[model samples]
Target: MKEVIRSADPRIAALIARQATQNRDRDQLGLDRISALLEAVGRPQDRLPPIFHVAGTNGKGSTCAFLRAALEAAGKRVHAFTSPHLVRYNERIRIAGKLIEDAQLGELMDRVLDANEELGASLFEVNTAVAFLAFSEAPADACILEVGLGGRLDATNVVEKPLVCGIASLGLDHQAFLGDTLNEVAAEKAGIAKRGVPLVTQIYPSAIAERIGEIAHDVGAIWEPRGLHWEAGVRQGKLRYRDRQGAMDLPLPRLPGKYQAMNAALAVAMLRHQSQIAIPASAYGAAMGWTQWPARLQQLHGGPLFAMLPKGSELWVDGGHNPSAAQLVADYAKRQWTDRLPLVLLFASLQSKDAAGTLRPFKGIATEVLTLPIDGHECRTPRELAHLAESMGLPARPCSSLSSAMTALAKPARVLVFGSLYMAGELLALNGPLPD
Candidate 1:
């Protein structure tokens, strides 16, 4: 899908407007167009530093964040590329430990798009191209990349070789694109396993793990699934990770949810498994608090969105939309704070997602739900979502808009804004701390 990116910078806005006209979706999984486009623009991927590529249904973004944090904490200049920018399109590409400035971003986008006008590249592909061009030219010690979609045909998969590859928590998501079965999904994720690279992954069901293993073997990747070649867990309020190399009992992640520790552990294992980069064990401890992935169980503070909530109410925003992701959010809600105030779920999601299944997990956990349409995309109407919530046994009602929802929400409660990353981006723009 073409991303509708709104930028305050006029230069960036122009580039985004031009990119919109060139956007086209890839009906099948392959990298012929992107690879050609990259070659046309001067194969920038070949110039990147030690690359840390990550893929999975979930937690991959967090794993990339942890990897960047750890490498930077170890005094390395890092270049990171992640998908679905929260607040700005520039958020997708970071150059030498800082977000690419508007001038730099606009120039890069124009250069890539202008050169590949007939290449028929999508917004994500062009964005990937821009990142590679920028990262290649910039001076950085390491590169961290998160797979935009499935690993096999993702634009970022153009990387022929990387220092390490990791797969985070797997789950049922994007069945329409990847596959309906867990084994198929696992194989799709394991496609990032490059020859001679460590394919670090979370422990999966036996069948799914074996499928991933098969892919690794086919690709000649070093398969290092958890509970086999490596192990990590949350124990005694600490994240303990161990492998043949050694063990490091690190602190928990600053991000909310118990699962973040495992994501951090995946990053540590990737670092430990590879020798291209020299990362200290102490950096792993620092990454526990150093990593910051916006909208992943992130709490808002005195923002425009937070001000809408009733007094004494808390506000948290998470962009995860899958049912497994919703369960994690529900679990965090149940464990994090006492229910002194009612839990109000302010939700919206894409029409393609299993909205009913995603919302069902939070049926009893949320005291009330306020549904709103995710603007600029095909989304489940508020009435439809409200009906689903009602069928799931929770009282839900649709509002005309977020402003209207805020106006009607006068009762004190803990509010969580859930759904698509597009919604998260809108919230961040209206609120503060816009993805620096």
Candidate 2:
């Protein structure tokens, strides 16, 4: 699938616009294109700093955020690359703890495009090459790479030797490319495991964990799972983590949602298990508060979008599109909304997503739903989404715009906007508090 991206800078916009005309090798999933592109550009991936690679259906981006926060807290200059930018394309590549400047990004994009225009590299492949090129030429202490999709043939998986590898919460997503079954998906994600690298992961069901372990073992990776090698839990509002090295009590993540604690712990475990990085216990505590990943159960302040809601009502947004992610959002709503002011969902989804499976989790929890359309991309019609929600025993209505949806609500209620990252980006762009 072609990723939708826009830029205010014309130079960058022209470069991105040309991508639409390029050959999109969606059916093929091998390293031939990316490897060839890298070779044309002098193989910058070989000169990168000690890397921390992460992969999963969800939480991988948040895991990378925690890793960058903790690494920077330890006084290290970190370079990170994540996907599906919420606001700007610059959010995908952070060079030396700052977003890549427009001048630098334009130059790099032009150079890479000119070097390998014949390779038919996808947009993501071009992004991966640009990030590696920037990280190699710059001076940084660490580099964090988040797998764009399934790890086996993800462009970011080109790294041969990372300092450590981690996998976050896994669920069924991108079944066409990854696999239909959860175990098959787990094996594809565990493909990032390299020989002698510490493959740290969250606790999973025995069957899923066994599948992951089998792949890791086949590649000679030292599998360090949560229950066996390291463990962490939230007790009395503190995150206590223990490994073979030692134990430490750290502050819970300042980011909202109960699942963020698990993401934070995975970062701590990855840092502690590695011998290359020297991260102090104090850094872990600082990271808990320093981490800043937007649009994951993030509450809105006084913004254009928030202003549309009824007075005294709360407004929140999440970019969760899969079944597992929807369950997390539903669980959070049940736990946090003690007053029960009635739950409303402003939802939209891509055409490729399982709309019914995504809506199944909120069957009984949502009081009402208003469906909207995602502009400039292939998406499910609002009427289609409304019908899906209505079929699940939830009252739903199709609206032309979010503005109209807010106007239709006569009562004050907590409004949660979700369904797709493209919609999340549209929300953040319209409102304030853009991702930094």
Candidate 3:
């Protein structure tokens, strides 16, 4: 059964891959294709439980993780769908707190592929349809859907009425698809808002905020902008949340980084604002301490990667690839290494990313940069990355492979593997480590 699924369905894979490569010009902003595909599948998207549709350039995944954890803590069965799976394709679809089984994934893919034979739907569109189909068939109290791309025409946006829509920390990314400016990006993320739904968002620059607000108002969504409707701050080693409903004192999120606190707060606010799921205060605390999103500032342990490092040595991995993510990573590393800094970085990014801007934050923080390829994806050559590092006054070397890079480390030094989530997935698979 696994073989049948794993074997290349050339016709399907080729079509999907082709769609992934197509330039999504702004003119291509409509849900016609996705709606048609879903309708052929019996409109499973309409049958889903209350959805928490999230869109952003960063922090959206962590927000989704917090939402699922909170719902599960309240003893509710939650279905979740995320994108660009780190390791297994199954990671994209979760049913009632479990990754979709191989057989079920295969069946759903078959149905979607069959339906798209004439429609030529994009890979994301087919996958979105499959996720809705599975979520509808399964019994769950709520669903958390993460946007696969810019929200306006993103396949996931086909869901007309989400319980609540959220836009996390936004930044410039996918410039080819989205736009060049931050305001353009904000408008794209804000496209998930629906009529009468609460569109929760983090505070952005005034111009960007106004654009998002305009989009929300245009859609008739009640915009719950941060600093106005809800806010959260870290004080006394805890996160304090306040909104019109009231205030709540919550423990810090188990997830590392100060940014996660905001993501957790967004989840809490979205839940608090919605009426479908009755999440108790206890669930908020549980979410703060129980949620874990892998490959985001994750410290590697008990794996082949760990074995290669010296005892007491710290090794961390994050899939952060853009400038905003780079800034966050820099802030976290700076706080973590006030006394001791990371020895080096094994870094690589897709051809389209701003490699120079992304690595700028690591200047002076990393002892050296060892560049390598991100398998199964278009990647910048290690030499290219090394040149960029050199231009920025950082010591760097291009390595042919990860093993070669690891072998070059002389002693136990803190190391970080970053740049692309696809690379992180390859590392986890090679180390036989499964995401929790």
TM-score, per-candidate, Cα-based? 0.97, 0.98, 0.94
Please, what is the whole-model Cα lDDT of each candidate in the order they appear? 0.87, 0.91, 0.86
CA RMSD (A), model 1: 1.3
Please rank every candidate by TM-score, starting with the best: 2, 1, 3
* CA shift of 259, model 3, Å: 0.3
- Judge candidate 1 at residue 208 and give its lDDT: 91
Give candidate 2 regions above 4 Å deviation: none
Tell me how candidate 2 scores on lDDT. 0.91
Residue pairs whose backbone atoms clash in candidate 2:
none
**Which stretches in model 3 have alpha-carbon errors above 4 Å?**
1-29
Give the backbone clash total of model 2: 0
Model 3, poorest ten-residue lDDT window?
1-10
- Of the candidates shown, which would achieve the greatest lDDT relative to the real structure? 2
Greater TM-score among 1 and 2 belongs to: 2
Candidate 1 lDDT (Cα, 0 to 1): 0.87
Q: Supply every candidate's count of residue pairs whose N, Cα or C atoms clash at under 3 angstroms.
A: 0, 0, 0
